[model samples]
Target: MGRLEIKSYEKIKEFLSEEHVGRIASIDENGYPQIIPMNFAFVNDSIYMHSYTRGEKLDNILRNPKTGFEVDRELEFLPSYFSHPTDASQADTLYISVVIKGKAVIVEDDDEKTLALNGLMKKYQPEGNYIPIKNNDLVLDEVAVIKIVPESIKGKYKIGQHLRTDSRLVLAKKILKRNSPTSRQTLKVMGFEETPDGLKMVDEPVW
Candidate 1:
């Protein structure tokens, strides 16, 4: 496993699309760091979130637009017991994560706000039962739409990427035996595939 750096924009976008919530970090008036989880939508190479027109987050953003955001999806836990019963400290969790360093700005344009809000609705409620958002909608004025334009975006996915070919095969078998949905996903992330003979590593492991 090399450094866990996800450099592909498409891969990061795919992971962002699957995730629902992201944590936004800001500096408060006292210069203390404050982090809040928000329902967010990633579109047009930016992150969008909605909040009350007035609040601590809004206040913080007004004072300083610079922000840090992160999103993560956990895969499975690997217990030390699987390798050595006595090495409890060796246990670790596998996961995919994305982090963003950006500047947050309140969207002043009604059209952009409508687009951002609609993107949120599509992400949270893809069934399409809700009414479309309009510029004249009463709720539009009451809610604040924040857009985060990323200065830097990074992603990391850890799933036995450092293991040797034989070791990865053994882990893949174990994951399959576990037969959980996450375990299945773990196999895919490890780039394992089923062949007529046995399991095969289709892609190079990514850390």
Candidate 2:
């Protein structure tokens, strides 16, 4: 648990968002850590995770909303790292990761709760037949939605940011040349002009 400084809130928010599955960590009865992977939504600068009213995740949060959560799109695992003669510190296995710590609260507002659920469905089931989230007499009590208010969010982008500026530039291009949203992100981080290549490699690379 290192101290995480906030960089661009938007960058980390992008990783926190986008209809992706994320994990939630809480404390269990023995005071040990409990983590669960779940689908989530983000709105109003708050992170959202929901489940049935009962479960380890729900129980822990009810007792304590403070928790840790994370979402990341690994840029590259590299499988291994090597060094050339000139660069003794040559590195490998680059990745883009974002970690967050915050207090999670269950959303109580009827409209907000409904909107949060809608956001989830649109992202996860955009093409499937629509399933509406509502509080009819039959379904209101059984469904529950939880919201996470992040006190601190820190993104550790190891995409060779620690490498020499020259090396970082080269790696950014390698990602950009392939081009995709991920590559486009790499380009933007490197302050490079983006092109059509970024869109092409969108599926191939993770930023």
Best model number under lDDT:
1
TM-score of candidate 2 on Cα atoms, chains taken together? 0.70
The number of clashing residue pairs in each candidate reads 0, 5
Candidate 1 lDDT (Cα, whole model)? 0.87
Candidate 1's residue-wise lDDT over 1-207, tens digit each? 245677678989988998998999988999988999999999899999999988998889999999999999888887676677798988877789999999999999999999999999999999999998998888889899999999999898777766777887887887777676687778778898878987778987643
Q: 88-113 in candidate 2: lDDT tens per residue?
A: 45545544566678998776777777
Computed on alpha carbons, the lDDT of every model, listed in order, comes to 0.87, 0.66
Stretches of candidate 1 above 4 Å error? 179-181, 193-207
- In angstroms, the error of model 1 at 87 is 0.3
Among the numbered candidates, top TM-score falls to 1
The TM-score measured for candidate 1 stands at: 0.90
Which whole-number lDDT from 0 to 100 does residue 103 have in model 2? Answer: 91
Clashes of 2: 5
